[model samples]
Target: MDNVRIFELAKKLNITSQKLISLLEEMGISVRSHMSSLDSKVAEEICRKVKPKAQEKATIPRSQEKAQSRTSEVTLAETGRKKPVQVSPGISLKEFADLIKKPPSTLIKILLGYGEMLAINAPLSEEMLALLAEELGLEVEVKTVEESLLEEGEGGTPELLESRPPVVTVMGHVDHGKTTLLDAIRHTDVVKTEAGGITQHIGAYQISYRDRKITFIDTPGHEAFTSMRARGAMVTDIAVIVVAADDGVKPQTVEAINHARAANVPMLVAINKIDLPNANPEKVRKELSELGLVPEEWGGETIFVEISAKNKTNLDDLLEMILLVADMQELKANPHTRGNGVVIESRLDKGRGPVATVLIKKGTLKTGDIIVAGDVHGRARALFNDRGKRVKQATPSQPVAVVGLSAVPSAGEEFLVVDEEKTAHQITAERIARQRARIAGPVRRLTLDDL
Candidate 1:
């Protein structure tokens, strides 16, 4: 057997490197650090000793478990406090401890036991604050800052969250009718407007179905747009896999499925060109079923709809299934909070300094708001909808083209509105500095662990 480093061995054995090192020192093994290596015989002997101790750690005594049950079983609601203390997110550890009237060291100890090693000044997420509060037998409310919400004209985290429209992505092989399907859904000839029927830039749009809305991302079928397609998958709540009935399943069709699955989003199949005499919907379904996407009609969970985008047939069924799946997810957002979302696509135009197509995931983005997108920040000079009409504001699940970014942000980067332009500038400056440092940093050599 080959020798292994202390840390790697500890990881394989499901124990901490420090604990293993301590055990080695107790056994007079004299391992220097977590990086120190041991021969096979010494490693086997160490494992023999460590396994029994690991079992002891794994099997807690009934007394301690019973004691833990009484505290762990009690949730915040069970505390029954008339007025709960509200904790704002992203507060520093020291600040949080001060607010809770607990010592910073005590909170640090709790976090350490919970497998976190944070500095006293390190920012704490709302979840961390809640965990600390629970450990102290206290009930605390976690929410976005009320002042920021009020400034943006949004109530702080609404008590009853409003349902947001589901963001859907249409993906498939090139010339397999993805564009035609989108045109049928939008009832607009977008390809006709573009030069040579090829879009200069594709982003996203919205369409109403049965009084409800669905956001559709215009992802082209070029290999160059694979990253953009992956980004679309990440933000999309549902992915519509458009497979040509005549062509069945192609390599790109499988690639699209991989991207959606990688993002862990739900998928629906659109069997396009079904009106063609050569169309084989069954063959398409069989190929897809082999890839783990069996249709619901065939006793699988994946939804499938045969549609002729040219004739605009069965499009209603597709939208209905999207809404049905979205309802099952209970998709919602707190529109009462400051607006924030992901950039769909961005570019610097000759006429317009910098413009970005963004999909709003939560809250509302309004005109004149100071927005920060990655390393760039600016005030929203204008907002345009999918139809190119100027809009005063965009609500949750709405995709709109935005104007007035300091620089074109990369697609998939998150954008959020700040209360002040000064804050936006400060944030962008910090992010820019960090990015530069990363770029300027020396190249790191690969390690065995990296493999």
Candidate 2:
């Protein structure tokens, strides 16, 4: 009995290993860690004093408990009233036990009865545990992750919103000339600059047309670059899908449509190579209309333009249509606040250390500003525009290459500009810790029969 581990004793008392360690130390017990063995007499004494207190703590309303502690149930004795247990989506088994005021061992027994074995801290979806809670005579109210984010975003006032440039993503099939269309608009040979004539990275650039500016994100059109295309759609205000006039719609074309639709961004189809002798703009329109992109000329909402990238015809009309749809959407973001944006791409450079292409979604990003992106943090050492010119700051809807990240962040990761280096480092540390916990923690119990 002297070989009893401290964690096993904590389990029996329904408390965390850390809490049990503190209690043992208060009793003059010299345990060094959760894995330390405790004498039978000392373990019994500790359990006798800790079990009732743990039960009482478990019944306390989560609102009044320590924020560091797991959320638990509302007690009838404490308030002379009953309240439905608050459960977040994907609640863990240990949290479920606390919310229902049941011992983890009891929950394990119930799971075994249903032919399922799960780790005590394994997460379970609300849908999988709803019936179980009802059978146990406990009411559960679930709150989803999306609802929380929406609530936070809705708290912003209308006064902070200002008109911003439309961010457009060019997407289509490989060799469908998405880059060539952008090249024709910018009056630069981008396709010729890429290695092997294939764009391997996401590029962000701003183009001025008719005294108005539009930010264009050129995403790789290959099927293997699906993730890059999805990220492009996420940060953009609109999608410009280039379809070869003679080739009609293809597999990657369908995927681009789906990505734009999922991001809820309006799409304008660009029928390229219309100058070719075999070009068929009408056929391309009809095929895309079948995929829910009915052309406005056909009495539908979608705007379609036929252009020749090589000949650069109707390119101005394409730019005008992009502004028309952007004006209708009334896209805006405040430029006076702290900077926030999404990482377009990142890599380690021999001369630059860590460099990233970031698209500024809101406010202004400047040199010396401490930036944090996912698990990375650093002060902006330098900012360069798309044209390779050094810039002091970038405003909303502008993309700049920033050089000074501690590590290259994943594409599509949201970055925020904090006031102090300490805050940036703290945020990076906290996020890194959370990610590690999620990876090292118990495996999620996905179903009733999961073992």
Most lDDT-accurate candidate: 1
State each model's CA lDDT, in order.
0.78, 0.78
What is the model-wide C-alpha lDDT for candidate 1? 0.78
Ten-residue segment with the worst summed lDDT in candidate 1? 53-62
Q: Where does candidate 1 stray beyond 4 Å? A: 1-160, 195-200, 222-233, 440-451
> Which pairs clash in the backbone of model 1?
none
State the lDDT of candidate 2 residue by residue for 122-222, as single tens digits: 98766547756766866777854322322322224455566789999999988889888889888888998898877888888998887778999888853
Give the lowest summed-lDDT range of ten residues in model 2: 56-65
| Cα misplacement distance, residue 285 of candidate 1 (Å) | 0.7
